[model samples]
Target chain A: MSETKVFGMTPTWRRDVHTHYCPGCTHGVAHRLVCEAIDELGIRDEAIGIAPVGCAVLIHQYMDLDFIEAAHGRAPAVAYGIKAVRPDKIVFTYQGDGDLASIGMGEIVHAVNRAWPLTVVFINNAIYGMTGGQMAPTTLLGQKATTCLSGRTAEANGYPVRMCELLATLEGPAYIERVALSKPQHILKAKAAIKKAFENQVNNKGFSFIEVLSTCPTNWGLRPVEACQWLEENMIPYYPLGVFKDFE
Target chain B: MAKGRVEVREEFCKSCGLCVAACPKKVLRISDSINPRGYRPAEQFQDGCIACGICARTCPDVVLTVYRIDE
Candidate 1:
């Protein structure tokens, strides 16, 4: 039998570096999907990436692209400035839950509300991964973190922000979608959604926001596979998945 | 007896078992031998593989590579 390689090691955007993520963390999967989308759309050369403070603060080490590290929770503002000046480049930002929904909330809201033609890849792992499992603004109720040892309660913690729904309420964004990296089928769909977001910017559609529900096994206190199962069982229900809003 | 072949980049494997769970053919398993990084890597434990690329797709570490075989 002759074997034809359907999938292999090289995705042009992926650099040759050891991934430092935890055993079960899906950040690598999320990175791969993002790379695949860029490869398909042929935007690697013109793509400019903005990474804010968090686990992926040094994301440029893994992916071979021009990257800028923004102030904590301020990637969206930086991205907007870059896009405004260099309208020819495809500007995008990769942000984490705490950075995007918490500290950078105002930056993101205003950027999307202003309708900047930028692609935002938001990774929501619920808890703050790099800072030692602290509760994030998107952390679900009943989930325990170092900051909230007992569990997140509505009275004490307030509520998890549904970013897609929140941003969809505004009339600025051209597209808003939430997808998970828990399953292979879902990963495929995630790749498509992300590709579409890049396409939107390439076609000069409008601001595109793609929320990725990811896993943090070490921080979540679960095995890698178990954390994925937990995401499917717990996170997906509250976060939900699908295109919350799309322009045409 | 297999219609597809799979290979795992063991050095990069994080021993997460995501590929094992994602494989529909049940061909991959965590190997007993640990890699240089001290984590057990995934291996092809059986013969019935359809090479659907699910393992590669689900791998969080970008470890698995799938190939379709033509006789």
Candidate 2:
């Protein structure tokens, strides 16, 4: 039964662009949440996105808003500049774990410390999806990656970096939340968190950071379903989902 | 009475089966047929659809759109 009234379609802010993300990759889900938040806020015309150097490096192709490509892990710093000049516009950065939690760590820390008015969507997929499944800073202890073929050990590889927990300790950010895309219920929570992060910027609040625990089926070397199940069973326990901090 | 139905844009579907797993009403299934892109697209059973849009929301590829008819 084909119906006529459209209850839901892809968000308009998302260009009619086919994503290159591997099947079952949650990056597309994250992309939809960002686009949906922009559409709901009616900020499509005024919204600007900072694309990072990761699996979502080609984010500009999927999102229809004005975008500037940032170097590896420097999206927050780039967004800082954009927000300072175009204070009237909505600015956001979309970054992946490899780019955000590793090389861009200092930049993100500084931006949050300064309380820049911008939205940051951090995708924490545990492994570096773009660079052929390399271990990322957010990779859980004992998680296997190309670099850590025998599983990450605390003795040699150090510990997984919990970005939300680290940033919430700072006094600058007004909102900080971590959500996941492993299930339908989790997806709804993620959307709400994403929207709140965007709303913080709209309300002239300080930095709003939403760290999304996403899945990397290709990198994780698992079927799409298995990847999501693995995320629920493994990732959620370490990176618990919740609002780390919210001033408002 | 069915409240809503899903339209699968076959060309874009990666056949990840997330929608099938997500449908609370259990109305979706991966078709035996494969798309030109070499992936199986989800097909709706059209029987118990409440049009909750959960399947569409859960879709990573934006391959499915939920449409509801006026009662």
Candidate 3:
């Protein structure tokens, strides 16, 4: 027989369909990673995904697993309720920068503080890609967005929030890390982290947060190629790479 | 062995002019004409690029890449 193939053509956790996200958007990569994790964990039959508002609100549409649409910034809380009642079910949330870092910050912090047994997939693209390229909490300084056409300014807008690094400081998150879907190596690493996060939940470890430094070319008024570069040069420096905290 | 070369899917290019600014090697140039999408997408790159993957790394669209030169 031929050598064992590491990657499969289509993940069992996905519906073998496409999403409405713009071309080259990292939402697809993030969705693929979640589908991969669900497939790897063999939880496809008993998995539930909470999708928040933003570009990926329709994430449930593409995923094959049981899905529910949560109010903006309320996914974590909703995931918590579902996980608490159906402790046997594997629960996760898919949220974007605006949903998590902005209006949903309180819910996210509270959930993590409670050490909820759920996995969180946070996609941060710097700008609000869905709402027509507005500035977001993760938007880099001097980055030109629709709201901040002249670029983000410290004096005016303040600096972007480093989500993973800051969350790692909290004593609740069992596993906290930031990964990118920009390339093969990074995607491999991200896949591993995503799997680990799900494993942590399955084993009842605690709060697991994986912030993906994703890209949004259409909103950024850039080609998919250039947006990835901007994320590396500008976003990575502020966010950095590696696991901030792991209690395993 | 040399590293791989860079690949750019110019069709998805919105051409906000970031790649032209990000490429330190000056490998990427902008085209005067617009793409079918109606955006001023990026122009073609000539040889002599180091294939550092910086352009690909910095791009948010996941469209550009630096291929292995030896391959």
**TM-score, one value per model:** 0.97, 0.96, 0.77
Check candidate 2 and list the clashing pairs.
none
Model 2: per-residue Cα lDDT over A1-248, one tens digit each: 44665545546535456789999998988988898888898889999999999999999988778999998989988898888888999999999989989999999999999997889999999999998999999899999999999999999999999999999999999999999999989999999999988888898988899999999999889988899999999999999999999996
lDDT by residue (A86-143, candidate 3, tens digit) is 9899999999999999999999988888887789989988988778889999999999
Q: List per-prediction Cα lDDT, in the order shown.
A: 0.90, 0.89, 0.78
The candidate, 1 or 3, that scores higher on lDDT is: 1
For residues A134-199, write the lDDT of model 1, one tens digit per residue: 999999999999999999999998999999999999999999999999998899999999999999
lDDT (Cα, 0-100) at A125 in candidate 1: 96
Every candidate's TM-score, chain A alone: 0.97, 0.96, 0.95
DockQ-best of 1 and 3: 1
| Higher-ranked by DockQ: 1 or 2 | 1
Task: Please report the TM-score between candidate 1 and the true structure.
Answer: 0.97
- Candidate 3: CAPRI quality band: incorrect
Taking the tens digit of each residue's C-alpha lDDT, what string does model 3 give over B1-71?
23334565666565545456566668787778776677666654676666555555444344465654442
DockQ of 3: 0.08
Q: Could you tell me the fnat of model 1?
A: 0.87
Which portions of model 2 miss their true places by more than 4 Å?
A1-6, A13-15
Model 3 chain A weakest 10-residue run by lDDT: A1-10
Model 2 chain A: which ten-residue window has the lowest total lDDT? A6-15
